[model samples]
Each structure stands twice: as structure tokens, then as C-alpha cells.
Target: MNELIRLVYASKAAFRAVPVTQGVEPSVARILMQSRRNNSQVNIGGVLYFGDGYFFQALEGDRKVVNQAYQRIAADPRHREVTILSLKTVPDRLFADWSMKYVPVEQAVRAFVRDRGYLRFEPLQFQEEEAEALIKLFHQQRSGEAPDIEKKSGWFGLRALLPRKFGGSAGR
Candidate 1:
């Protein structure tokens, strides 16, 4: 069976990373390698940003596999206060090639703006359809259920933001 295409986004945890048996950076790298080597993922892809003692990352792949990856990731002594950013269906796989890859924000921001246009990238907000998908993703994340991402809902979701609790006041 062909794996379903999906995307999972998370804005670094608030508190602190989970208990890392290893040190810090080395332990993180080790966990990433382990995940790539022995993970049940279809095509995990995303970025990890380090700022304000928080780590924001997005992982995309098969719904089941991706969800499992999140749980495992949380267990790591490298992240905490996990607040999922978004997880929705995309006609295309964001990163179908790599099992796991780093997203250089400086480079990715430029690319995202270029591909999505200045307005699309700005506070421009999601289109009616995208809003619904994002909302569904948020709900799924909170309830710990598979995203109803593919379905279309209403528009109020555009204002439905993830609680500030997920993001602690740290970064500038």
C-alpha cells in the first residue's frame, strides 16, 4: 500500500527537552541518528530551531508513523512542552527523499516565501481551505488523534491559535 502524504509541524517545547541519557548536542544528534536508523517512519522531514531554550521542529510522514515519532521524540531528554504546530494532508510529500533532514531556517524562510509568494508567507493568513485543515490538525494534536486534515471545515479556524502555554516567553 502506498503511504499517505502528510505534514506534522511543532513549535519547540516550552518547559525543557525530555531526559536525555546522553549530554546535550551529542545526545540530540545520537537520538536523531537512532530515529533515522530504527524509526517507524514513512518520510520524516522538518527543522529544529534552537532559541530561548526551546526547540521547534516539524516532522511529516504517514499519520501513524509520524505520531509515533512525536511520542518518541518527546521522550527524549532534549525537548519538553511539546506543542504541535500543524499536521495536515498535502497532495505532495514535503520531503519524500530524506528519512530525516535539518531545515536551515535562514534558507528555508527564503524558499518558503519564494514558493508561497510574499503575501502567502506573511501574516497573510491561510486561505479558507488551508485554515480548516490547520484547525483540524490542531485539534488532532491536542486530542492525540490522527488528523482529520484532509477534510474541509469553516474559517474561524484562522483565528484559532495554539495556546500560548506551548510557547514560553524566551526568544526575542
Candidate 2:
């Protein structure tokens, strides 16, 4: 059987706000478009959540390919303080159908944060488990699955902005 791996990570946006681009499209939108194409070519799949100057991404694919892709992400100037939250070999991908799913900062997520006493979705303030939970929550919401936000066990703490994980080093 082919080996599959899941890599989860987060990072802070280098810019304080989404920067305007030369074209009609916003920079973030261009990034999403480019990423979707690139990820598809490499057979990578994942979900990306951007909010409050932060990013939480989960990449799943062949171990080596995922690692290579992550290297490029870490080196990208748009991302700062990239940190890995989890790197595990899962039986299957949680986001296999998506090349790069971008989760918008919608009302449901805002409500979830406010109800939890968080002023915003500042991932840097979240602990490892909380980061993972947030990623799962967004993924569920994007996939039209009902997330059990009432499960209090999964949310807590904030440390750094970006969470990233892969089998190899960033420079590789």
C-alpha cells in the first residue's frame, strides 16, 4: 500500500493585514489560487485557515513530497514564525478531496471564538491541542460536517501564530 502522512502547522501573516495586489484579485486570493494549482500538481491535499493575522494549515500526502512542499512554505516571506503542531502517519487523509481548501473567517467561526471568550481567532494564543482542534473545527465546517464545539476538552491556550509539521527540515 502507498504510504500517506498528515502534517499540521500554523504561522503568522507577515503583513499586519491582507495586502492589496496589482491586479483586481487580492493577494490572499491569488495565493489560494496558486496554492491550489501547485498542490494539485504535487498530489498534496490540505485545508488552510486564515484569520486575525494567522494561518493554520494541514498537509497530507506522500511523506517526501509533503516535506518538500513544507520547505517552500517555511521559506516564503509571507509567513513568519512557522511552527509545526503535529506530524503523524495517518491511515488516511482528513482532507483528501481538497487540494487546498481555504476556510474563510465566517460568522460561525467568529461566534465560536467569542463564545469561547477569545477576542479573535489568534492561533498564536492557542496551545497545541487547541490549534489542532481549531483546524479540525474549520475543516468540519468547510466540509459541511457538524462540529461538536460543546466538547470542552479540545480548546485551550495560545503560544505562537503558525503551526506546521513535516517529516523533514524546512531547508530541505
Candidate 3:
């Protein structure tokens, strides 16, 4: 029997800004493809979103393998900062193994920041449409449901609001 568990792992990861400037998008793509390939061997489904020099990925699989992969990703210098928002285990499968994904934040979402207003997205209050879409995606593993995730906030990194002296900064 294929044992499955659902997880809504919310992660905030910031990458080295230099790589993006150096036209490292190809390398990043390569890394993503390779990660997905390797994951297939271990029965894992990894999906990710990117924007503002950061990445947020959701993965589901065997507990041991998933845990190890998470450790590796956290250690990867390409993305030094990682803040896991929530980790919950569900009774059913949330994703199909061997499935990996990506979404351009802007293209995948509806609302964007305007004039630095905090009125864009709220935290943990995904509207009915978004909530339904998310549950669908989680249950089916592939349903154009994103920018929805962007609607929720509270995604503060412990190291994003302060200076290096404060150990909380997301800028260079």
C-alpha cells in the first residue's frame, strides 16, 4: 500500500541576489529540474513559487526522504535564509509523487503591491475562491491555484526586518 500524508509546508526562502544579476536563472532552472528528477527516485512531489529574490516550495513524500531533502535545501548556499511558516500532517495525499512545479509570482497572482500599501493581501484569510482552489491543488496536485497563496501575508522572516547586527535583514 502506498502510504500518503498531506502537508501544507509554508517556507520563505531568500536566494543570493548576485546569482540572479549574473544571469543565473538558467542555473536556477537547472537546479529545479534536477531536484525534481532526483525526487522522482525517492517518491516525492515538490512544487515551488518564486519572486522578489525568494522561493517558497511545498513538498510531500516519505517522511525520512522529505526531511533529508529539506535539510539539504536549507543548507544550500544558493538560498541561505529559510523560514518555515507551518508544518502540519494530514491524513491523505496532498500531491502526486514526481510532480514538481513553478509559478511566476506576478503572472500567477491577481493583486500586487501598489504605493507600498499594506492593503494588498491579508494573512491566513484566503477568500472562498482561493481557499477552494488551494484545497483542490493540494488534493489534486495540479490546479492553477497560486497568486492565491500570495493573497495571504504574515510571511515575515525572522531575518528580514532588521540589519545584520540585529540578525534580521533581507537586503544586501
Candidate 2, run of 10 with poorest lDDT = 150-159
TM per model? 0.46, 0.70, 0.55
lDDT of 3 by residue, 30-94 (tens): 76777767876777775665555555566677666777777877777666546554444646545
Which runs of model 3 end up more than 4 angstroms from their true locations? Answer: 1-24, 110-172
| Residue-level lDDT for 17 in candidate 3 | 37
Better of 2 and 3 by TM-score: 2
Best by TM-score: 2
Using lDDT as the yardstick, the better of models 2 and 3 is 2
Model 1 residue runs over 4 Å out of place are 1-7, 11-24, 39-43, 106-172
lDDT of 2 by residue, 29-61 (tens): 677777878987888888877766777788999
Candidate 1 structure quality by residue, lDDT tens digits, 1-172: 5454354433333344445443345544565567556532444654333333444455656677777778777676555555554556666554343344443233444444456555323312334344334323322232211112311232223224434454422232
Give the 10-residue window scoring lowest on summed lDDT in candidate 1: 143-152
Collision pairs in model 1 = 12-55, 12-56, 17-78, 17-79, 18-77, 18-79, 19-77, 20-77
Q: How many residue pairs clash (N, CA or C atoms closer than 3 angstroms) in each of the candidate models, in the order given?
A: 8, 14, 3
- The CA root-mean-square deviation of candidate 1, after full C-alpha superposition on the true structure, stands at 18.2
Per-residue lDDT value at 103 in model 1? 32
